[model samples]
Target chain A: MQYIWINGNSDQGVSPDNRALAFGDGLFETMRLSGDCISHDQLHLHRLMDGCRRLNIPFSQATAESDFKLALAVVESSAHKFWRLKYIVSRGATDTGYFCDNTVVPERIMLLEPFTRDVVSLQQHGVSVIPCRWRLSHQPALAGMKHLNRLDQVMARQEWSSSDIFEGLTADSEGNWIEGTMSNLFVVDKTGCVITPRLDNCGVAGVMRHVVMNTLCPKLGLLVEEKNISTFESADEIFLTNSLIGIVPVTRLADKTYKIGQITRGLQRALNTKESGL
Target chain B: MQYIWINGNSDQGVSPDNRALAFGDGLFETMRLSGDCISHDQLHLHRLMDGCRRLNIPFSQATAESDFKLALAVVESSAHKFWRLKYIVSRGATDTGYFCDNTVVPERIMLLEPFTRDVVSLQQHGVSVIPCRWRLSHQPALAGMKHLNRLDQVMARQEWSSSDIFEGLTADSEGNWIEGTMSNLFVVDKTGCVITPRLDNCGVAGVMRHVVMNTLCPKLGLLVEEKNISTFESADEIFLTNSLIGIVPVTRLADKTYKIGQITRGLQRALNTKESGL
Candidate 1:
């Protein structure tokens, strides 16, 4: 990392009693930083605040904005040309238990790392994905919030070590295709209609996924559907999205091969235009 | 907290990049330390290793044992009469991402706290509990491992703040009674049979639960049954167990009141004998 900050102070370490480490009691946001600008800063902050509310962690938008500004200044002072900013809000340190004192100030850890566009080629030619044998447990109580209880994702990511596999597509225990390891999945049918997995049960409601459904797709005159998608057999195209790697098309999954369809390309171009403007 | 140790060294902090803070990628054991000995040290270590295997965190028994020994020594030299030893093993610090390098040696944080025995009176007269509205998500992949993704428990614990309620009983998403916010639940039938919720879907397979099922129950001539226990209507007695609080009888839940039954008392006596010998 080029820069690190804790609760807006320059620090690289956290107390062992931090609730984030104790009980995965926190939320985090990872955003793509181009120069001094963060992509979809408002949306990221909105989601973080939403998570804090649901998890009952105290969050102040003003304080977070100030911290972001300080982190950006630190990044600017560094020699890194491109950056990936990670903002973590944990329930701070406590007196050695799960019962938290809500009055304690929340701890914020901000990290800025030199960006490496590992998926640049994958975005262009599309990437390979595999069906992860591990199924995500369905828990609506914690669904759709980007809290730190991500053992499910960590286990899914460990299913494969091959560099060739860009991501692993995981299903819920009930056999519904939920999402990719680190991104949201969108599939296009032959009729040009878009469908993404409904995340009411389990899955991160990614910021990029929100952008595609609410902004880009509507602008392009496409209707985005959210449902329990079981099979990719009916899909004409498939892609993944995250804040850092806006959109990545999946070219192959096991024996099935997919090509970059027109809708995928059009969405990609639109997203590029929007990102470039940012 | 009286003392803290990280990787066998006296330390109070961890890197912000530590996977435990970032993703809650860790497992922890809260063990009761009586005098110079940690109660059920073997069972605690066994469960920790099992958690490591299930979560794919690299674990060395010798390293963990040595760390535990050093931490115990620190506690022994301290002035505290009673102690609680918390052993945590995280996937160490990594490049900012969920994708881990399995070769990285896991980080160990051992915390020593002066035990307050906050529930001593409750253990005698029995404590009141209420059913939590927040349901535990069912993820078979992460069901039994006492890994650090305990946001479910934290949220459940936060549901009630009444000092009269000592614990909250949480159910799985499907309405099956699973466990307490911090302990495992057991129900005894009038026929002298003991039933604990089947943890195939969700709930921490606590070390104390293991000891009760494997070692103590059979010795007391109790046939322990693990099944989907949906209702406590058939229960003649109710109790909870954890490493710190061995076995806590439940006197009341909502309007339903229960007295300390014969089987519950028998098991409690057996546990007391075992603990006293330790």
Candidate 2:
């Protein structure tokens, strides 16, 4: 009845020598488990595999599938019924510095926790965000991969703590819009075109961001483009997306206000239909 | 009796919920131990304290002094002599996301290992290095701190594994020189002005680099400059520095060759006089 599982066992704690703890040599996926379904699991697995390939951690597709199944079984057996699952893959434990040894086995740790985000309230009456002074660093090698080197996001989150502020939008060093501290952002221009910042330089390519860009927007016939977005002042509408909160529109950013436009409502409906409780 | 200590105790392993494993919300200092001495103790402590302030992790001066004293005591009690000690300060363990809670108690894990390096041969013959395809990311927020988000360094280390190659030179995305994979880089030009890449934008500010810049070069009355160094073709000498390796000169880089210059030899002598078996 344990909610934590490390390498398919619930008894083992994390090793002090784990490369994740040592050098952040790992990847992680935060997925929403609603009822019995994990939302957009294929996309999560795809990104995880891509991260593994980039870091050379040797996480095979078969191993990911097997681990996912184990995670599913553990979630189903939970007595308290968990909602959020953080699946992590570390480059195991090693005393070596900066060297990714080929002989090292990857360690997977899955933790399920009870989560209750008031999605309906937030979606209906959007969320207020602030502009963070903290900017993201551009590393094309590690960009867009949801790896564990997230000190940037951690720093960005410290920018705002007001109860009214739902998130803080962080930009790159050049002032180009990157993403929210915990979610992906979308900007709708006056031409009714949806735009998200290009993640080739920084920011995570979130699972739900992929869903909106590839599925919901296409289903609604709305044109979405990915580019370097700098100003949000002229944006007709704005919204944030992540696995936990499917699509929460932004109503206020600093002093500027944005209407929860037609596109946002449309995407919200589409996401609701796709992910029931999300 | 133990070579490892986590918060003054040796029995506890790292918690699975550690933010270091979760988001790399941590800082670490690797210091060299010879007999009863830890090399450049004040510099390492200063860096660690500065890192805590930057990350907003509440660590008191009294606590750091206490932990350091405890670390020294553990080393003295060890039957197996330890040469290398890695002092880690994680943002502790939490199930929460990006927003760092201020009340969180930072976890300190100190690991001591028996490390051996043939310093004389490498310092005399010098080591060969190659230019890395992997580049460092520019983050003003994290520049110069020896934090745990070292995936850039981890990836850079994998670029060359030829036993003959000791390190790789990693530049920033704009092709400006940053640092070596594991050590700081210094290039002595034709006019005898020693230049090292500025770490204001990126790269770890190593303790040895600080010692060389602030102490050794001044002692020799040598002209040392910190700026953007792109080409090494016109360099008279080159060297690498870290807590573990101290000052090891570079004899070969890619196709070009360099001699172990008089400055390197002088600095080596100064360092030896200062730190006896370091």
Candidate 3:
């Protein structure tokens, strides 16, 4: 990473007793930075604040914005055009126990690193994915908060080491298709409708997933359905979305090979031109 | 805590990029130190190592033992007779992401603090607990490992602030009684049999719980059963077990009051004298 900030201070370390390290009692946001601009900064902040409310962590958007501005300035001054920004707010340090003092001030850590993803090429050619054997556990209390308890994702991502496979798809224990290891999943149907799995039980609610569901799909007159998706029984197209990669089309899953359908291409075009405002 | 050690070095802080803080990608053991001796040292180490194997974190028992000895020596020279020691081994710092480098040497952080629990009073008079409204998620992959994804426990424990309530009992999403907020649950029946929740789907497989099932229960001529326990149905008596607190009899759950039965007492006696080697 080019720069690091802890609670608005430029530092590389945190106390050992920080509850984020202790119990994963925290929330985080990973955003893409092109030049001095952070993509969907407001949406990311809103999601983070919502997560803080759910986890009962004290969060001030004003303070976080100030910190983000400071970190962005550092990144902009560097010799890098494309960078990744990670913002973490933990429940501060605590005495060794799960019983947290809710009144403690939260600790904020921001990390900036020079990162580049070949989004154009990956989106154009599409990527291959595999269904992971490791299933996600259903916890409604923590289902979509983007909180720090991400061992499930870590384990699922470890299932494959093939450089050809861009991502791994995961499901809940009940065999309901959820999302990718790091991004949200969307399947286009024969009637040109977009179907993404409901996040009430498992999987993270990604920021870009929210944008597509609320803005991009509706603008294209496509009916977006959030329901329990089974396997790719009749899917016309499959794509993934995240803040970093924006939209990644999945062309292959195991034995099934899919062509880059019309809806996937249109969404990608809109995302790059009009919707993303890049 | 008066003293802290990180990776065998006496340091108080960790890198901001540590995986533990980023994703709660770590395992920890909370141990008790009494009169310069660590309680259930072997059991704790074994549990930590088992967790390491499950999470794929690099661990060396010899290195951990040596570090523990060094930290214990520091605590031994202190004035306090009773202290709480927390040993945490994270997958170390990484370039911010969930995908881990298995080759990275794990970071060990040991925290020591003066602590005392009135086990005598709690055992003699028993304690009151309530069924938590928050339920544990069913994640068999992460179950029984005591990994750091503890937002479930943190939320459940936040259900009550009353000092009168000693602990909260939690069940899985399917309504199967799992464990206490910080301890494992045991229900004793009129037939002099002991039953604890099956942790195949959820709950931590505690070190002391293992000791009770393997050693204390057999010594007391009690048949131990690990099954899906419904909330106190046919439960003649209920008690909790953990490494720090050996046996805590649950005298009350909601409005249902229980007496300190013979099985509970016998097990506690055996634990303190024979099995625990206190």
Best by DockQ: 1
lDDT per residue (tens digit) for residues A67-147 in model 1: 889867766777765688999999888887778766888999989887877656767899999999989878887889999
Q: What is the C-alpha lDDT of each candidate?
A: 0.87, 0.86, 0.87
Worst 10 residues of 3 chain A by lDDT: A269-278
User: Which residue pairs overlap in candidate 3's backbone?
Assistant: none
Q: Which regions of candidate 3 fall more than 4 Å away from where they truly are?
A: A275-278, B275-278
The fnat scores of all predictions, in order, read 0.89, 0.82, 0.87
The docking category that best describes candidate 1 is high
Deviation from native of the Cα of residue B140 in model 2, angstroms: 1.9
Name the regions of candidate 1 deviating beyond 4 angstroms. A77-79, A118-120, B118-120
Error of 2 at A62 (Å): 2.7
Between candidates 2 and 3, the DockQ winner:
3
B92-164 per-residue lDDT for model 3 (tens digits): 8877766765677788888877876677788889999999989998888888988988999998988888889
- The per-prediction CA RMSD against the true structure, in angstroms, equals 1.6, 1.8, 1.7
Per-residue accuracy of model 2 over B118-140 as CA lDDT, tens digit each: 77678778999999989898887
TM-score of each: 0.97, 0.96, 0.96
lDDT of 3 by residue, A1-278 (tens): 46888988887679988999999999999998877788889999999999999988877899889988987887778887778899988988877777866588899988888877777788889999999999998899888989999898988988888789889999998999999989999999998899999999999999999989998888888899999888798899999999888888899999799989999888887788853432
